[model samples]
Target chain A: MSKLSVIDNKRCVGCQSCMFACSRRDGNAGLSNSCIGVKSASGIEGDLTVVVCRACADPPCAKVCPTNALIPKKGGGVRLQKTKCIGCKLCQQTCVIDAVFWNKEENKPVICIQCGYCVGYCPHQVIKLLK
Target chain B: MNAFNDTLSRVLYIDVKNKKFWVTERKDLFDKYIGGAGVAIKLLQEECPSGADPLSPENPIIFAVGPLVGAFPLASKTVAMFKSPHTGDLGESHAGGRSAVAIRLAGYGAIVIKNASDMPIYVAIHGNKVFFRDATTLWGMGSSLTAARVMREREIGTGYRSIMRIGKAGENMVSYASVTVETYRHFGRLGLGAVFGSKKLKGIIISGKQTLQVTNKKTYKDLYDRIYKEAVNSQVMKKYHDIGTPINILNLNNLEALPTRNLKQATFEYAEKISGENIAQNYLGKRVACAHCPTACIHLANLREQYSDSPYFYKTTFVGYDFELLYALGSMLGIEKPEDIFMLIEEVEKFCMDAMSSGVVLAWATEMFEKKLITENETDGLNPEWNNTKTYIAMLSKIVNPPNAFYKAMAKGVSHAAEIYGGKEFALAFNKNEMPGYHTGPAAHLGFLIGARHSHLCNAGYSLDQSLLLTQDVAPETIIDKLIDEEAFRQILSSIVVCFFARGIYNLDLISQLLATMNINYNTDDLKRIGKEIHAEKYRFKCREGFSFDKLEIPGRLFETPEPTQKINKEFMRAALNYAKEKIKCQ
Candidate 1:
């Protein structure tokens, strides 16, 4: 069994603090390359949709990777090898939840590694580990 | 160091009296201040003449955004600084929208408008070009919403652009007038709108599209993802997104800290009607957001009302309500009906009035009536009653236009109005700015008096006082010392262009880490040094303008009211004032 970061929308305040934290973890000062996505629907923020990699047991993103850059991880998820990635963006299109974010600067897909560092910063208990 | 070429641009200098525009590049200032309120403060200090009238041409109004703006997500706020027509001191307001991004993308670090225009005009900035268009047609438009719509229609760019315009209240030089940006968001404090009106400037429209670059691509991507995830999933962000700031109403009311009936009481009798839970259920029509903001905390709701004159039974009006607005216009005025408060908020927004100040002023008027300060002749045969939304709306219009003697006096704000009508003892203002709804403890009142810019959040002294009381009873001197230190530290955060809401996130260690990424290395000690310097600079300006902390007028009513912490001692407050003055002078 593998643990994945799950979002509870009810606990989110939409401050975007997590976005900045994610960008900072990657050593960036801005939000252009963050893997997580938080966007409101029709400007009504009562229900915020937090999009992150679901880390499926048999991932569709890994299967679609032409160069095999996205390999199956030990924890029932997939990991991206930037060196092997062809920047084909097949994984981005294949993911239904739109969790695989494309790093335009690196010409590679940014998938959540399940490091769970983001879980600590969520003061509202919106982000939780799911086994 | 120049990872983003679009970050650095020429500063626009506009002289309204001469009707001339010029651009000057000052990279040194941007490098040091990091723009936003930091740069605006420096510009105000440089341009504004000492003892100059806040509404006079001599007073300079500065608008600035940070380097992270336009390039980063959630960095979408513009900071405006001017000599407040209300406070008659350092006036600062920050609003989130495309305003900051538009200005940054338009190739400018800041815009400084000096002097007054001969006639009504609007400044239009599209990319690198700037034009002062005749806005005589738009002058005295009565409603800010109508003016914004007209400007939006005439403007070259739609969406991704910011249109900041004033209304009839501003044109009429109402002391608490505000400047509305993006139609709903406003620089809603200390009469920035009146400052614009005094300059004979009706509005400012800015639009641009420019890309920004990062220092490291791989690391930037990783860091960006981390921040995005937290922003979306964090509890703090969720609270803002769910019911918005109105949630504070319930918490504050439960804590028995909600200011009611002009601070005559602490807790509002009708807290349930104005709580976030009730508002979210009854109203909360839409939750709009600023450009690049994922949180979407803005709640704009439509209030349905029946028209007595027409065949149509009901009409829906769009209004934005938060805890502060609700408390100020609703409970503070003894208003229980949510719909009535909504209508009052709409009228205040329409006139481009600062809801906080407007509500406080109205509450003062109602109190004046109770005290027999004015008879039927003064109120134009209409009683200034509590919770009367219709009368409140009608009075607000009169205040905007000044049809009678009462309206003219009221338009000048509570401090001035009280001065004329002999109600200075309970004017509900500290250094000319109306008190915010946080009569929780002495810390709140003390914080308002000593805090830079006279805002509650500057030191959040009230919250500190509550914490101290909860832990153990502490001496007033000890509390004052802690508050002064906290306020000094907060100055550094503001100088770095960081939002006060993220104080916990941007602590000393985190700030050092964030700054290291920008190649600006500074430890906690350096931050303290810079914070103190900035605080001194602001105080220097205030002192030069004939401000005296020792001479601060403490309202007598504050002594009568028992705060959450208990009755505030007059001698204790006087000692705190003395301590604050000594600290500033020594610095």
Candidate 2:
């Protein structure tokens, strides 16, 4: 399966290479465009909690999207129709893991499309794409 | 030029006296000098008046990031420049946290802080806003880590902002204290923390978001992909990702270049216990990277400690460790065990002092104590014994707290301490900045003597020493020429604010390509010439501050110790330094 999973969180070093990889997939250079977010657990002192779309069977993000922009794919992950997205940000608030990232410049939601690009950048094997 | 072409043009000016702030467009400066150290030196020269005290109100703190910052990979350092409280001239240090990214995205090429605050404060920047928050509570905070915690909770913006703070030693204006960033990285050397403390500033918080633009999208993408692939495939980069800098412990020990027990020996018998392999095998819990850097070279040790008050309570502390620090706190101080070294580094972190200088001071004290140069009465009834972590730890507390006259002397660093305590022969400092953990040979010593900051990183003469291992022998003139050239080229790298670890990937050709994307035109020769120009400017500042080659001192301890190269002598070092001085004047 192409859907991503946080196999281990403790192994993460807060390198944010995965965040860059995600943004690079969307043709950007900085963190402002990334769909995956890695924030400190308790400031910069403790371990990092890697937040990314886990491709839930019944995604809350998809259900909260009023304009049907976030539709579930044939598999598990949700597909985004950019034109239909009204930028309500309701979907972003609904997700428990806060995986629905915002495109600050475009004012649109950046959802993971089940691509395994970021998994390659996680040197510690923290992120995985599984069946 | 348009705003996009002039991306690195904003300069934030903070007058700490009135706690007032303003911004000025410095495109004229950045256009000529580029950013980071290049721009920082110029700003320092313009902002700081001649004959001004390093700890006075006129000493301006200049922090700069380059054009490649936030726009390119591994160009992640923010260069800091001021009058050093340690050396009293041409202070320079660089830190890689979110600092470079935050400042760049906040739309400033450099930040200049002048005058001293009447009250303690920390600067908080978000977009164009600068807030002077009261830091009276944070001034005497037990550790820099706790202060960072309080500021982190108070500051806005997450996932991107940087929190830089000082600890008790800095508050006490200890000359070699450091300003720690993110609990791991630092504006680590040459008294940046003391400068911060002198200004009644506790820390700084920076946060912003402004997307970087490129001249040609396709060219940018192609170059980015090429560099990314090169960085990922590089064995050098992979090595950094694996064990980080602690990898040097075994290599330097094998070469007998690792300075141990204050250069009494070149190799530590217990090298393996504090090695990168050992750390990776046992305590390496995490590996963090600086902003926009794929090479996560920062290795943090996970130390499990039970509470002294409660047997059942345990806390796992993450302590960042690297080669220089491990050599300084571990081998040089005669701490054999990894846990003991980690604890020593932890103590250093708590006080926010320079690890290299701290270790040098302690070793000097220990050696003097052993030679019957001083009594336990001088050492506050604690024996200054090598390999005794307990005594060392107690001495470290005294160095920060400075409970007695001896501790007060130690707080000033090895040079000043030796000046007071009669260990000038074994002071182990160059131009007031303590020597790094390298006993390679003459080129290393010469580099320290002639280099702008007298820092090993200023001109990596240790590498030159190791190179001589294969070539057998070289003329002093040739060695001087080589190091001068290295220093000039490193000026450009620091101007670009790229981490020196990625020096292999960001070669001249690649650097040229990256600059082209940013709309600056520079070929290899142009880059080299510009590098020399920057070096000349920095030297001009140093000279203006009354630094001269004639006044530069070489510690007698260097010649007394035999190293791997075994080429160190007063005659060779004198000639090499003289040659470098002449060459620098010509440049």
Candidate 3:
């Protein structure tokens, strides 16, 4: 199983450098299509919680998808087939970590591909890419 | 250019008196001036009447975000311009939070607020719709945090939304009042909050979720990646993310340039207790970043207090502590304990007062009290003593709601207060605005005296002072030139409205690349030229406002104090300020 590991998120500064890296990979400069989410544990005074697709063995997000749009990859994470997909936000609710980010501009659910582009951008080394 | 981000060329004008707002496409202004301070200065020229009182409705508050704000890393500052109640000249302050991103996403290059509301109100902007909500109840709130919470409940947007509010100090129109942005950041200088108070503008909440399209998609992404990598990997940027800005405390102290006891001494004996390293080691709760900024330089101190009523109960709070805060509240006030400094900072934050000015004013008061200039009668039966946190905490409430004439004088700021109270020698202010926490030498003091805003943030003259002492003895003429040149270049950065922390990252070449994405093309030389022009434009506003370099007074205390760069004499500072004046006159 291949997934991004949150080694120690207590060190997370909530800079969201990784979040920008997430969307910029797809030539976007916003969080609209980003799968990863880094929110303050409560306020900015607390630790930041890095939420991304943990590459669940039997992902709940895929099980809850109304259509077969969310196809599981051989390694992990879900791949979307945009043609058959309906804009039902049930997949967003299914994920316990709320890693299923919604693209408000285009009603689509963005899931992590685990390409690990964000891992390189994190100066704190809080997140690491493991295969 | 990308269709999504094209709306940045639009400017939103809000007339609070008429209770009407309109949007106009000002691509012409954006084309030449760019956005942020650049465009705001032009707007200030056209809108603000000359010789208008800072607290009058004629003074318009201009908030501008640059093109690269939401799209580029470290481009997280929003420049707020208004007539300063303190300086009575060009009032400009930059704050980093969700302000820049929120403004850019709200689809405007600039938001011009004009006129005054008859009643207290807060404006909430969501996309195009502007709601002027009655904020009479929120007005005169004890803590700015409480008002922000009320606004949060009333306002719809979250996460993307920014809540900028002023507290009781602002309500009372204290000259050094700051507008608290979010819970941690602020437009914390030159009396922006007092202007908000005058307009009866309790706060502003802005939010939007619009996606921007890049002009050269491939090149934009590639360049974006390059900067991103450099920001996350560079040693300079990493320092900010690590210990945050409190790191400057130790460095400044080591150089014997950290102003303590209101410039009576250069370095504090107990500086190590409240330095960035100590704060991070002992009290650092968390580090946070401004919107779109990769470096999380903002450090919040974790202050936990035990509740006396309930045994085994503790209430933990987060108070932001930077080098400025430390130098002002800690060393300057003689508050050695880190916890005590954080507590004082929390009080300062709650009152929404500029911490630098507050510290300097308090220090001046302490000196006056010691000299028998001000008695307890003037202090409302409260003693003004150094290193006493309790006295200071009580004094803040009085500053917010000044009861007697003396407290009222203090509320005006150090310059005006000293003018009336007869302590002009040790007032420690530059051009009416209280001096910041720097005592490097002549360059540092001269920069404050001659700077457009009378702020260290205008140009880091302390850096020049340090290098000169360590390296060579540069002439006052050369020093003045460096200061002006630095101020001019910084004008470009502030025009772009990027945080000064990313000075290295957003150099001319990179700024050019970033502007390319917004379809505003300019080379390095063009940026430098425009930067100089923008600097002059701000001076034009200052000169129109009846400000002259000759009117600048360098505090005698600064001359008496000896820093690592040696004793700063009046003649040396006057020579430098005169040279700057001559240069401005020539321009």
Candidate 4:
């Protein structure tokens, strides 16, 4: 089992390289489809907060899903079944961490599948892939 | 979402007076000049009328992001063009943060804000929607930080959003006011904030989630990886990420090139106290980066201040510092202590005033006070002296919120203040814009006179002063030629809108490859030609706005200070200016 983990949020410089990388995996640029997000903890001068799926053991988003579109992954997190989704955005509200991002064009939730693609782009080693 | 080609040429225009907005496809402009400074200058020409008052409604505020924005690392700069209230000519300032990315992803290659509002307002752009929110309550905020935070609360989209606002200095239309971006980064030079204030624009919040697609995905990935590797591993980038730009303090001080106390002397004796190493070791709170940039160059220092009423009660503040800030508020003001400099930094940030201009203005005021040219009556009972952090802090506020005639005049800028106060000889301003941190040599001074923006970054004359002139003697004509070529090439870089710090990583060859991946093809010569054309366009606008090469002021203070290179005189500068004039005329 594999999952993405925050090594230390304090080391984050708010570069958003992870966010850009996350979006780039689907052969595009910009933050529209990024499953991960980063923003200032306070103002830009303060610590940066990196928000991503924590890959819960028993994901509440999966349990609350009316269509069963979000399937709970083995170790943690959830996998999306595009055919089952109804574009309801219930998973976006159910997630405690607010890590479930929205694909506005498709009108669906974008969840990380624990690919760990962003780990290599974190210049400060703020995040890592746990296996 | 449209294709990248179509979306990249879209220009969004906003009229604050009529509360109307429109979008147009300007493929012609983008194709000819590229984007960022190039497209911005063209838009400025089309929008701003000739001989119009800079602080008047006729002047347009232009913000443009380049082709590389949102797609490349270090390509995070947004070019802001307006008629400078400070220079009364071409005003172009670049800021880093999420501004460039936000503007680009909002589906605009450029945004033009025209006319003025009758009342204070903040414009929020979320994708294609534009909201002219009444900012009556948010107006008159003490700090720009507070204004931005307030706007942040009212807005949506966190990671993709950028908030830009002005403080009291801008509200009062101080000639050297700056627009703070994301708290730490800023459109910091030539009074863009004054323009914002003139238009009654309190703040601007922009956010978008648009995605860009490139046809050749494999090539794009390879190019991105190469650039990323270079940015992460380069010696230059490492220095920027580690100690940041303040590391220049010690080096410049050693070379006796750092301007100290209104250029009365070239070197500061207490440079070590405010050195980058000392600050990074003692007070570095954290480092932050502009969106999409791998090198986090912006350094914030933790400044803890205990309330006077309660000794134990304290508030910790984060103040961003750079080479310019260190030179301006630290050495230039003779404030040696890091804490005092931090306090001064905070004061300038609160007022949203350009740190360099504020320091130099105060430095001139201090010298004038010493000379008895201006007394306490003029200073409102406050005596200003070198290294007096408390008085300087007080004066910073007064400059924003003027209590008397003297402070009001000072707010106009050093050139205007000196004209009124009889200190023109010592006034360290180039074409009405305050001198940057460099007093390197003739090249640095000449660059200020000739550069389109009258800024150090315009042509990096200080870099040339150190790299070429300091090592060996170079002819004035040769130096002028080199300066022009460098400045012209930089026009292309600014068009791409990449942070100038990554110029090494994105050379002409790499830029060609990067642009190719974006489906914009240009050979080295074609790129150079476009660069030259863009620079000439900016100069044409400057000329139309009453800029004259022969009439450019070479301040007497520049001669008083000793530079590392050869001593520069008025005769030398005049000859160089004449040569540059002839060369530019031919171009």
Best by TM-score: 4
Chain A TM-score values, per prediction: 0.89, 0.93, 0.94, 0.96
Q: Please state what fraction of the native interface contacts candidate 3 reproduces.
A: 0.51
Model 3: pairs clashing at backbone N, Cα or C within 3 Å: none
lDDT of each: 0.75, 0.84, 0.83, 0.89
Using DockQ as the measure, which candidate wins? Answer: 4
Task: Tell me what TM-score chain B of candidate 1 gets against the true chain B.
Answer: 0.95
lDDT of 4 by residue, B154-234 (tens): 799888899999998898999889998999888977999999999999989999978887758888888888888899987
Retained true contacts (fraction), each candidate: 0.12, 0.43, 0.51, 0.77
B28-142 per-residue lDDT for model 1 (tens digits): 7766665676677788989998888998899998988766565444557788888888878888888766687678767777999988999999989987777888888888776
Task: Give the distance in Å from residue B221's predicted Cα in candidate 2 to where it truly belongs.
Answer: 2.3
The candidates, ranked best first by lDDT, are 4, 2, 3, 1
Error of 2 at B409 (Å): 2.3
Query: Model 3 chain B, poorest ten-residue lDDT window?
Result: B451-460
Tens-digit lDDT track of model 2 for B173-225: 89899998888888877888988999999999998755677777678877776
Q: Candidate 4: list runs displaced more than 4 Å.
A: B1-6, B455-458
**Taking the candidates in order, what DockQ does each have?**
0.09, 0.46, 0.46, 0.81
Prediction 2 TM-score vs. true: 0.94
**Candidate 4 lDDT:** 0.89
- On TM-score, the stronger of 3 and 4 is 4
lDDT of 3 by residue, B1-587 (tens): 23444777799999998899999999888889888889988999888998998999999999898888777888888888988898888999889878888888777779999999999999999988999999999887778888887887777655566889999888889999999887889898788999999999999999875666787779988887787778777886877778877788888888888888877888889888888898899898877788777777888878998888998999899888788888888899988899999889999899899998899899999999999998999999998787999999999889888889888998989999899988899998888887777777778777887776454344668888887844677778888898888888888888877888889887898888888887789999999999888889999999999888878787778777777778477777777777888888722
